[model samples]
Target: MSRLVEATTAEPANPEPVFLDFSSVQVATASYLRESVLAFRDLVRGRRSTFYPVIANANDDVRDELKELMRLRGDVLMVCTLGPAGDVNMARLIGDLDPKQRMTFDLVHEHGETDAGELMRAYGESEGLKHTTAWNNRLAALAARGLLMEVSQGRAKRYRPLFEDA
Candidate 1:
């Protein structure tokens, strides 16, 4: 575990995307994964980056365990898997998301940008969901968690991706 920290902090000033390459190794108990990967991610989250894994190769059991951990982290964290053709694809984070936040992230990811009013207006007329105050709280929380980038737009704010490719 401490070795993981050392490898991560090698370029602590501005660490590039770190990947715990799980290609050779085989068996990994859940506790082992949580202690190693999740703990490292939390430590990195406080500093320069989030713990994003790229599963180069792993067997069925190991893959299942890792997938469960990723799901627990939710959209705030992302992982990748190498395809047969060597293409990098974002792994599906299997978890429940608050409806508003799911929409917020989807909009920003799809449209490349969005604001609270835009979300409010869209949801308001489309679904009759008028909850601007709730939107404020939700967006603020997401920004603070580093999931979305909050930009002040004079009297308002716009949300963008923190690490997502736009």
Candidate 2:
């Protein structure tokens, strides 16, 4: 008779709250996909928020993991990043989640910086997007909705979150 070997891996007994940020290209890679799932599960052991800038190529898998985490913790907010596409994508993703149970917010400001035009131009070139009037319109909408607040309006308009309770 041949002896059979069983391997066991220990999971997190107590998980800590985590905020996940993923790169669009990274999520598409097989290695990153596996890492993302494991990282998400480990992060959600206690409480977690899965934040992504936009619906990248790897959104499906991330979304699936988020759904499973929600089932366990009951407090998962999937942040869909909306660039120049506007609020349609944001609304669609949030609508798919448990609307009444979870809270949704468009992550507009980072580190109390809100000059989106300059920031967009600098970053959009790499993303294959343009900094145009249309982009400004999209940003305006977010500002109107209280998602982004302008601290200084001039050549450079610094922006930050409306509230920093968290």
Candidate 3:
């Protein structure tokens, strides 16, 4: 576990998604998953590294266990299928998000790339978020959860889905 965790720690020069491929092998217990997968995520996130971890091609049993564990922990992870050329073919989120966060995530996914002001203008009245701050908070939360990638634009920040098609 330590060795695997260590391998994931090396920081990349530019921001890039790191797929933890689970193409084969059998079942993984929650305890093992928690100690290894979750631990690796925490370590990378803690360091504020650019290595975004995505659970790729996990089997049903493994996905089930991870979903249950993430739900219990109130966290989320990007899950996806990668094409032969290593592009994200299909993507979805595992675990959970609050209603507002989920709504905000949906908006971002639909828009491709957006900022707080745009979200407020588009959804504020309908969603009861009259202020950009409210929308910004939601965007920040999504980025913190690793669901979105934040890019700085002048004095503002714009967010996009971590996986291209997510």
Candidate 4:
């Protein structure tokens, strides 16, 4: 785990998606996955690290292990397929996202980029969100989980989908 963390530390110091490709791995134990993948994500994101890690090309067995681990942890991660040009061809979330977070994620995905106040006005009534604070908390939570990219515009923070077409 420490070695994996150390290896990732040498990544370029710029904000970008870091793909952790697992095309060769046929199997991975839950404890190993948790210690390496999950721990690396937590440590990097906790430090406000520049790179966002995305799992790629994981086989069914590895994916299953990760899904179970994430379900137990109540956290989520992005799993994606890279295109020939190294673009995200498709992406999905693993683990479980509560209804509210899922809703927030869908809203951001559909709208492109938005802020809490905007969501409050557009979805507050229909979504049972009465105040901007509620929307803000949801967006903040998604950002913390590495599902959304949080950007600052003056005093207000806006969030957008980390993947263009996830």
* Backbone clash count, each prediction separately: 0, 2, 0, 0
| All candidates in order of TM-score, best leading | 4, 3, 1, 2
Flag the better candidate by lDDT, 1 or 4.
Answer: 4
Q: Rate the local accuracy (lDDT) of all candidates.
A: 0.60, 0.37, 0.82, 0.84
TM-score for candidate 2, please give it.
Answer: 0.31
Tens-place lDDT digits, model 2, residues 99-129: 2111122334334454557656655666456
Which sections of candidate 1 miss by over 4 Å?
10-16, 48-58, 67-77, 83-87, 113-166
What lDDT does model 2 reach? Answer: 0.37
Best candidate, TM-score-wise? 4
Candidate 2 residue pairs in clash (backbone atoms < 3 Å): 53-81, 114-159
Tell me the spans in candidate 4 whose CA falls farther than 4 Å from its real position: 7-14
Lowest lDDT 10-mer window, candidate 4?
7-16
* TM-scores, all models, native as reference: 0.59, 0.31, 0.86, 0.88
How well is each residue in 67-154 modelled by candidate 3, as lDDT tens digits? 9998899888888988789978679988888898998898898999899999888878887866899988998887766788877667
For 1-166, candidate 1 gives per-residue lDDT tens digits of 7987876554433223455667677888778877876677667655535333333455667767766766775634444565678555554333445787777667777766677777778676675667777667777766544456566557787767644552
For model 4, how does the per-residue alpha-carbon lDDT over 81-119 read when each residue is reduced to its tens digit? 887788787789998899998989999999999999999
**Residue 103 accuracy (lDDT) in model 4:** 89
Which one is best on lDDT?
4
